[model samples]
Target: MISGRRQKKLGVRTLDIAKRLLDYGFHPPTIYFPLNVEECMMIEPTETESKETLDEFIEAMIQIAKEAEENPEIVQEAPHTTVVKRLDETKAARKPVLRYRKREAQKQ
Candidate 1:
């Protein structure tokens, strides 16, 4: 349970960290809920994960912290190695393109 406020000035956003985690082949933890804490990240390792796996996750988090300090932009724009890039959530919600239509269909 690590809250991101400790390094907020460095532009360390919880969403950015979560996105970066995807690059390391791990799912992002639940973030920014339970309003008592700001930019909260709850990482609960289940019994299914071995010790080595937990260690790997810790190492990845450390690396991400370093990257955030040295190259903040990288952390800000995460998921660089993924197939699809980030999306504008507000825009998507406001103007959603749910289905596709051919040009001929529109003309008819």
Candidate 2:
């Protein structure tokens, strides 16, 4: 288990990185745990993972880092490729969308 700290100077939170990873076809590491550490990302690569997979993850991370510096907005508003865009977690918590709606029926 290796935990890496985010660069506060980049003005990007661990959540942002995690979300952005989805766009890169990867899941983001666990973030903001071990309360003692600020802006922490914990990655535990299992033995089942191949070197090629790890290499790809590293490349994606490097790209994200560059994006964080070059265009923070891209990193801030991540997972652009996902079916659902970013959600307002605070608002969702306050007013949860409990029921599922069929899109076709709604269109009718």
lDDT of 1: 0.88
Candidate 2 residues 1-108, lDDT tens each? 333355357787778888999999987788887667777778888999999999999999899888988898998998899999999989999999898778996888
Error of 2 at 42 (Å): 1.0
Output the worst ten-in-a-row residue range by lDDT, candidate 2: 1-10
Per-residue lDDT of candidate 1, residues 1-108 (tens digit) = 788775467987988999999999899999987678888999989999999999999999999988989998888898888998988879989999798668996888
Clashing pairs in 2: none
lDDT, residue 70, candidate 2? 89
The parts of candidate 1 lying over 4 Å away from their true place are 99-108
Where does the lowest 10-residue lDDT sum fall in candidate 1? 3-12
Error of 2 at 77 (Å): 0.6
